[model samples]
Target: MEKIGTIASIKKEATIYKLTNPFRWFAKFGATGGLILFFISIVALVWANSPYQNVYEDFKNINLTFSIGSFVISKGLILWINDALMAIFFFVVGLEIKREFLVGELSDIRKASFPIVAAIGGMLVPALIYYLFNQEGDLRNGWGIPMATDIAFALGFLALLGSRVPTSLKIFLTALAIVDDIGAVIVIGLFYTETIHLIPIVCAGCIFVSMIFGNRLGIRTPWFYLIFGIFLWIAFLKSGIHATVSGVLAAFTIPSKSLVDGHLFVKEGKSLLNEFEVSFSKTKTIKHSQNSLTTKQESIVATMETACEYILPPLYRLEHSILPWVTFVIMPIFALANAGITIEGDLFRSLSHSVSYGVIGGLFLGKPIGVFLFSFIAVKLGISKLPEQTNWTQIIGIGFFAGVGFTMSIFVASLAFLDSNSLLTNSKIGILIGSLLSLTVGMIVLRFQKQK
Candidate 1:
């Protein structure tokens, strides 16, 4: 039976994944929030180069501290944005990754092959391009910047095209972007991390392991994971590893299994329906009460909430609950904090520097070439199949969109050029230009393909 179950799992699952519920939130609210992010970015740019630049600079440097007994955290506003708020963003990404592997597009190996293979190509070719351009010196470290494809921005552009997009294309893009995020996390955790503090790392490991044990023990409460996860994050922050990685590590320990199994859920649902019918017969509703639920009805309704939780679990609930905040608030704050590059006279020259060239080449040229090339080869080799109803033209269009590497690319740039203000500015120029170009070209192709 186990062998049969494994084989069945190997087979492609049905297209149960849809742009509904929380995914819909990412589409609708995410797109709206993407617009907010863009506006905030523009505000940052204007404020940075304007006469008020010093004020903005001063505001960012204001030291904020919090303390509890002997323990305290002291950081600037920028650190709070990069190190703290972005950690929540990564947490949501971790939850999505967990869900994807367990039951989404990535559940079946064969089905997962298309995006995983394409994401590999997408990452490698960009890194290689950046390396070729800047292999001589310090700028080589920024290669990972181009390897990201911001899922929110990419999907926001797709959402703009409305019914013109094929559902398969949406699924493919989402899956590919998620895989791309996994690669970025790996790169940050490995190459970008600096000097390590082993003591803190060991401390974090012990707590993380305890979280896993808690999951195994059927401890489904969220507080245990979250409170411990905070300790783990702080440990990583001190350990010289990026604190955001702790979120991903914590996410793996979240129980994917529900309290109620599918068959049991269905059976319970039918029993509840019968109970509802019986209760309705005995309970009288007042017209002035506007069909107010009777005591029996209220009791049944309350039980349904528990059943819903049984079906969804805390992992999904947390992801769904916080996604809007991440999109609407945290992401915009990140943009406002990080996107304010001073495009002064000398800074414009820096836009033509080596770091700029490498990043632009990698994102604008390398991204499309690599994505399309790998996906084409995968289909040809029979390793994966094309998404339904999507032709080569649409595939090419999707490849272009894969180059829109804004959020994660900028995040990586902050890591890569943590100290060099000049190189960081140059890299930001490349990211902004490359991403805008991808958006412009991708939209034209996807929107007008039917006309052609």
Candidate 2:
């Protein structure tokens, strides 16, 4: 009894340590991605300004082709990254969005109200601010550019504040960002695009139906979705709606529920373990010889694999495996491919442009006001109460943090402008300036609050 108690105490201490440092693991994820982005940005800046500038330009301009019989898909490297690979990114984003809505922060109406209302205000106010300044012709279409929060950068910044920021505050920000991402997706699908073709649209619809059926049928393997999702992506790309929209659609069709619940999983798992032990005991192993283990070992291994299959949720598995790849490889490559903006004489002229001003102002000014005001109103009306241990000052600081719109803002900027060069430069300038200002102000304010 004494030994068992000591063992249990040791296990409890280990569990506590793991729980306390949960953010450390996630922080490393965000940090690695940020580092990759930083290095890529540096390389791009150098390459764009170097004697090899034309090489860089020509590389991006290089036409890539994909053809199936009479249907040929051709685009520049930049477009491929923005339209194709970024679709996978959006698909992952969609998965996160769905999970949050179904079971995470946005699951309960009262719990969701603060972030949902804040996200709405955050999106609407920035868009309105952008539209007010850029109401000229095609520039009016760029209003969505400022309405996004870059979760990676924002979370990374929050993590840097250590325990000064409450855990509840971080949760609030994360939830708000997730809601903000949903709004961005809707805005992109609805407002940002042009004509849509019916044939491809029908094809996409059919694929979606098939995916739904797969979910209903308890199909667990990822291969079916991957193959069909590629086809759906192509169909959507051809349909003239952005290919990235297909990612969101595909993610929506993925089954969030496990085939077996946790209670059943544990019961079945223990049964499988007992069976495996029985099988192993039947085959007496002499010096751990492979021949001694025989067919029983193989059977036990298979049973263990089956048990794992039943126990692990597909959504959890997918998120765990793909998250590292998406953050480090895909996103960094995207930044490298897109972040290069050749600074020229007309750079100042581009800065003076309505699109540039709209993006900068919307992110810098609109995000905080929108987030705070909406949150305050929601709490006041009793739709949602503030997170426990979080004050208004912390909320305002988080609002500022929300304005650090790097990833999604750049993505929207790419879609918003027709002329790539002007868009790229303006977006880089705006993201740099707005993100810097938001970070500086948020940090200073939070520090002041802590001191007080």
Candidate 3:
């Protein structure tokens, strides 16, 4: 009896520790993802500028095709990465957005206001700055380029700062980035879309409505959403709506409610676990050389697994399963695909272009100014308050961090300048330069500041 009680207590403690120590887990994930992305980007850049530039181009232009009966889908490697894989990325973003609005930092109006307003400022000011520099021509379409905040990269930098960064500030930056994501999604859907096909749009609408119906019907299985979500992506893909938008829409349909209550789960889990423990002694008596569990013990374990699944909401489960893939695999592949740009002669001369200037100026100069200015005004106007244990300088640092708009900026650039390779190359150059500057300056600002 005493041994059983001790083992159970130890298990409970282990579970509590895991739940309470998410920061370390998240920090490792962010830093690893960021490093992988950075390394991949560097590799792509080197590969593009080397004598093998032709090889790099060939790699990106590699055509892939999938067909079924009368239906066919074909695209170059880069387009598939940007259009198809990114939709999965956007789906994860959508899940985070929904969770934030439902229960995370954005759940409370007062808590959400600071980051929300700051995000608006961060997005608008950079875009306006980009537009100002490109106001003369088609370059204005690229305004969306600098308005993104790469959360993975930003959080990775923050993780490097370690103990210097306060938890409140981390929360502030994360919330701000999530809001920035929402803005990006809206802008992409509204402004960046190409010509629309009504039949596909109607099909997408019908599918989306069915997804909502499924949610209302209390369907908690993730496979249901996953299957329908693929169809939704296909519909949006055919609708000319930049298929990634479907990711976000499908995310909103995932069931956020868990099937089992927390209390009931704990009760059942303890019972099953205790039963398994008792069966352990019996397994020892009938021991196989492989150390396999007895049938009764296996059944108890299976029931426990089911209970664990029931206790977690599908949205969380999906996010947990998919986020690691997005971070480590999809995003790094994206960086590899899109971060390469051939630079000829003088780099400064390349930067001299008005389009390049717009991107650099918008990201480096405008992002910090916008974030700080808007937040300051909100504080002064009593619309929002600064995060606790944080100061003005830290907010400025965060604003600069927001300027590290790598992944999404590159994604938007691909769309904005799809027709012109020269323009696209120039934009990629600006993105790389601007993001580097943001990362460095943000580090300097936050690194030197003392916590209050």
Question: What's the CA error at residue 3 for candidate 1, in Å?
Answer: 64
Off by over 4 Å in 1: 1-30, 285-292, 346-348
Clashing pairs in 2: none
Model 3: per-residue lDDT, tens digit, 170-241?
Answer: 999999999999999998999988799999999999999999999999998888888999899999989988
Candidate 1, residues 282-384: lDDT per residue as tens digits? 5544333324777777898889878988888878888888898998899988888888888868855876798888888888888888888999999999999
RMSD after CA superposition, every candidate: 10.2, 6.1, 5.3
lDDT (0 to 1) per candidate: 0.87, 0.82, 0.91
For each candidate, how many residue pairs have backbone atoms clashing (under 3 Å)?
A: 0, 0, 0
Residue lDDT tens for model 2, 1-452 = 76688789899989998897876665465455655666787798789888999999998888999989998989999889889889988888888888888889889998888889988998899889988987776767678888999887788767767777777888998999989888888888888778889999999899989998998898878998899999999999988788899998898887787666788878877887787788666655434543355576677778768777777767767877887788878888787777677777776686787777778888888988899998899889988899888888888888888898877888888887756566557767777677778878987877667622
Rank by lDDT, highest first.
3, 1, 2
Better of 1 and 3 by TM-score: 3
What's the TM for model 2?
0.88
Q: List where candidate 2 sits over 4 angstroms from the true fold.
A: 1-30, 274-285, 289-294, 346-349, 447-452
Stretches of model 3 off by over 4 angstroms after superposition:
1-29, 281-290
Best by lDDT: 3
TM-scores for every candidate against the unseen true structure:
0.90, 0.88, 0.92
